[model samples]
Target: PKTVLLLFASGKLVCTGAKSEEMVYESIVKIHGVLEDYDLLFKDE
Candidate 1:
């Protein structure tokens, strides 16, 4: 299943519909990596 991601201006990520906590965390890490590639990651909190 595909998860829904909500990225805010404050660099806060809201991931929904993940089957498990581990999946959510994994997705967040991937998303952060993508953002970092573009030099858009300001915080990881």
Candidate 2:
């Protein structure tokens, strides 16, 4: 099953419904990659 992500207005995130800690990390990484692919994430100079 896919994990659920709860994003807050304050820039906080909550990952839930994952089978393990590793799964949560993986999910977040995947999400980050997608955000980068779409230029949705800010890059630090």
Candidate 3:
């Protein structure tokens, strides 16, 4: 399965994949983890 991750200033994520729902969830969690590690999750308004 393949996937792509997109991040927006609105603190939204867009994911496109051709796999199972579990995969989508895992991908989202992983992506968020990466972003958090880089301090890119989000900031106070």
Top candidate, metric TM-score? 2
Predicted structure 1, TM vs. truth: 0.74
What is the alpha-carbon lDDT of model 1 when measured against the actual structure? 0.81
Model 2 residue 7 CA deviation (Å) reads 2.1
How many residue-pair clashes does candidate 3 contain?
0
Off by over 4 Å in 2: 43-45
After superposition, candidate 1 runs with Cα above 4 Å error: 43-45
For model 2, how big is the CA root-mean-square deviation?
2.2
* Residue-wise C-alpha lDDT for candidate 3, range 1-29, written one tens digit per residue: 37897777777777887388888888888
lDDT of each: 0.81, 0.85, 0.78
> CA RMSD for every model?
2.9, 2.2, 1.9
The model with the greatest lDDT is: 2
lDDT of 3 at 44: 78
Per-residue error for 33 in candidate 1, Å, reads 0.5
Clashing pairs in 2: none
